[model samples]
Target: MKPARKLFLGARLRRLRRDLKLKQVDMAGKLGISASYLNHLERNQRPVTATVLLRLAETFDINVRQFAAEGGELAGPDQLSEIFSDALFADLDIGRQDILDLSDHSPGIAEAIGRLYTTLTETARRQSPSDTSDPRSLITPETWVRDHIQAHRNHFPALEEAAETVGGALANRLTMIDTLCHRLRDAFGVNVEIASSTDLGGATQAYDRSRRTLFLNALLRPENRAFGLAYQLSLLEFDAILTRMVQEAAPSDEGVARLLHMSLANYAAGAILMPYGRFLESAERHGYALDPLCGEYNVNVEQVAHRLTTMGRTGAEGVPFFMLRVDPAGNVSKRYAGESFPFSHYGGTCPRWLLHLAFQTPGKTITQLIETPDGERYFTFCRTIERPIRPTLTDDHLLAIGVGCHVRHASRLAYAEGLDLAKGMATPVGPACAICPRLDCAYRATPPAGHQLAIDETRKTISPYPFLAD
Candidate 1:
């Protein structure tokens, strides 16, 4: 055919060779071809035939179509072009081809650029107060929730199946925590005792490295005890599996990756305790109700919700859920999810949602449907939980925290059946005024930092709230 057509295969082959970190001589030897002949093929001096392509595929354990397509690849250039177009690079003096070349030749540079961009963005957000007010601001609270969910790919079929299987046995045992304690004693011969008043100075769960004994604090709530037991069990049963999963997840942040590793280990422990199939059946039988599920498992609302997101493990998968833990001032401490939820880079922005209102009605579950300016709707449930700061001391105080989740998949919940979701509907809320374009909001605290404000002495519009457009 034409010279251009011939060159396509050559370029793809070159790209693949580089991606595999293979040298020309090594690849030529594997293909039983001369280095000179391979070089000619890569330069489009010779066309790659079907038989050669098949042989290459067999040798590399790749598909024949993939081998053939690699000979004349166009995908890499397109992807490189897209990466260079990112807003982070908008002000930088760079060309699309330069980015492609860098990505092809030096992936490290591209990754460095990404990290730098993230750091700079974070700095900008912290410096500007108005940035915090914009519901659409990149640093809003929803970002953390979204990232946690994205990290897990919103799937946990194994955990769900395990919960269903052990849920019934756990239901009758007074508490999942108690059942786990018993399991520890039976399986490992480790007697788990909550520490009494005299033992208050020691660690909550201390493993006598010398005696091989395990001691747990007696004062811990049932859920916390169960979680501790499961966490310990994970270290014994699935350390290698957890390591493998962490490696596969390839988290960008070391802290987050470490947390994910520990979380997965705990998840494995929970799976071993509950098993997947039984939990799924119980969840379905119970109509996916939170209170019943929590009672059945001797867990709390937050724990139940956290476990619900893990139910994607087996045949009975539920809608992916995202969970967040935030304080009164809108600071998020923890977030986990099984689906992609959009928010700013930092946290969630939508302020009008029940999550914000839940702060006003402390110690109660607030349910509401929130709609964003973009018309995306989410059903949300929120409530506050308290934990004492110091359990051993008589004067120890309690800290109140709010936990929330979206109802995108709440149809299976027993509590969701009779609720009227449409009446007196309030529009979804966003984080702050800076990022949110809703100019008419009565809650606008200050003008967006980067936006210019308009002044009108003649007349005033109710909603235009005079912010100068940048």
Candidate 2:
């Protein structure tokens, strides 16, 4: 079935009526509709139908296509609404009507405001979490590191090539531990050993150059012990390559560039563990299943999740998944994407997103089909992964790792086995409720900025606030 051809001429219609110095009844009579119906049109309650559009253009002596051919082509209203939703403008009492007028007549100013709002948002994300509200902390190293990786879609070509070369050096090796230990000793003469957690001062992996040994957390499982070695190996053997990439990246912020040094090495570690070609093949054969791939590759769940998001290699791309890791408090720690999605970069992801709930069922993978307010759909899966401090210690880091791709590729995933793509709620979600355009969601945290607020003493709805007559 064909979608409806809807139009939004409310702002323009009202402007035309006012310019002609005519009242609602006069315009309604001219257009052959009830005055209430004309009121609805002026309020954007209904799309301007072709018949009404023809009447409007003829009555106003204007080009019919001006009001019909590209109806809704200008979406300044939606963008401006997003801009005003920022906490910076939260105090202002701007209404939907004002937004519409601004976009309808002064679109340039509205767009400039929107751009400024976007810049503010990007900068805010860089601020240290401890001093997020301080304004000055808005330029932090973590932000730059994240932005740099995001720009590259978390795939560094030079690092990947270096990692492949490193992998090729031990093509016939069996165990990662034995292979990496031999390479480290033979190439750099650095010994690898798994030490008691306290010996490494509780660090997952530590290097002691004076002793010529790399100490890993004794509590780590065999796979993690190997990963610890792999991480050190990348820094040890590919130091020059990683350093060159960091230098070439050369962020204006010294702190950011310094942070990328570590980020690049970590990227190399993941690449080396799951060499691009073999990992891509395993991912495809396993339906990109996290656990199975984790087992086959001898890595942890988070490692597999992180690696899956980096399959954006040219001429050999895999499904573009957007991966995000969050703590119990909903603080996003790491986010990597091989494609764009509607989640917020600076604010809390929608509480309604299942990734948040994944914590409740630790170690269990939850599959979901999500549809954002904009109508984009995704096939997403998430599970909780625990990083223990030691073998017998109670202290651990519980994080939820989520990975998803656009829904068109749903069939390719094992998680999508029983999903009814055609007839499910599809979990209407968005970046965050403040700027989200979904009017019907009961989970909205705040009302969208553009709409007028109404207090109806006689009626109540499921959500705390109900929008007045739209």
Candidate 3:
């Protein structure tokens, strides 16, 4: 038999101690170990024993699996690998092991590098107007909120509990839209009214906080009407929870804090609409099929898709899925994840990914098996969805929702039917044309940034942009 792997979690231990603001002696005493022993453990001079690991978990109320993992932070390893893969660092010739070691030992540094990369990429996109970047100022409020949500794996227990309470109170109600409206009026004294689109000044929904009234555009569908009512109810009913979450996030500015608050409120609304216990049961019973869940919960497919990304409750967790919604112009409007999707931080996504093709066949579900450049395969499904109508605004709104999980979880999904999953062919895709490392993609729209182009004056290759192999 092979030897058991030794657990040397020095960096994680040290980081934990620092985070808890405990000195080595204090931590050692709490762990029932000598300070010298703790020091040795922190230096990786000795492997952590099972007893010590258990003690650490008990003392800190943290999962020991985090200590065992190479990187304590969930997003660290992948972000580090992605950052180091840039051609700017190509000359360094860093390998996967080195990246893992850095992520393991110096996670704070790794996080700092990730932040720098985000800023750099955001800045670059700003210089090239044609490139896709947040239209807001350089603060990147959306990026901050996205990172915050990903850090928590898109689940918030407090919000879930509040939503469950609301849902239970309204469980016996037959008409959800009417139920939501009645609850809003009875609980918060806020009257819900459908108003002409011209009166709302082109907004889909507007709330008069002082007057305690909500105005929803007449053009909104029944699903959107219910959503608007639920969103308003969440804001009024769970303001404290939402505020606490935003404060805990410690966003860079007030704008980002407000955005985070709005996002949490949206999560609360979804949870309230589809309570955790009932939704998870229906999802599993239907093999996680999108349409059945939509019909069961009286929600739209986009709502169901977004809800799937938030099914990361501790004990009753569902499949860890990542979701993205993009318009025909390739603008990603909504992205949430219980799993990392390796989304591009700078420019547009890979054109070859089936998500782009979803616009062609509206209202039809299409599934594909795709492999990233790193050889990680996933099973994904995409379908077109229309945004909620705003009669006063321009009417060209259409979007595609793409949801996927790792290939290991494919067998559990209804969309993965009839495929030889073990040996099935997967279309190879990468992050974005600007950063993708795929050297021979025929559909590459732009050359890989920061790499020397492999120019051939004599002959032409299938790929439009060829770069030197490092």
Higher-TM-score candidate of 1 and 2: 2
Candidate achieving higher lDDT, 1 or 3: 3
Best by lDDT: 3
Model 1, residue 51: C-alpha shift (Å): 29
lDDT of each: 0.56, 0.74, 0.81
Per-prediction TM-score to the true structure, in the order listed: 0.62, 0.73, 0.84
Error of 2 at 25 (Å): 60
Q: How do the residues 280-377 of candidate 1 rate in per-residue lDDT, one tens digit apiece?
A: 67677887656777676656666666665665543345555556776667766655554434444333445555565665676677766666554556
- Where does candidate 1 stray beyond 4 Å? 1-114, 121-149, 154-172, 175-179, 196-203, 249-258, 270-275, 285-287, 347-349, 388-410, 419-424, 449-452, 457-465, 468-470
Clashes by residue pair, model 2: 96-450
User: What local lDDT does model 2 show for residue 170?
Assistant: 67
Off by over 4 Å in 2: 1-83, 90-138, 171-174, 388-396, 468-470
Measured by TM-score, the strongest candidate is 3
For each candidate, how many residue pairs have backbone atoms clashing (under 3 Å)? 48, 1, 0
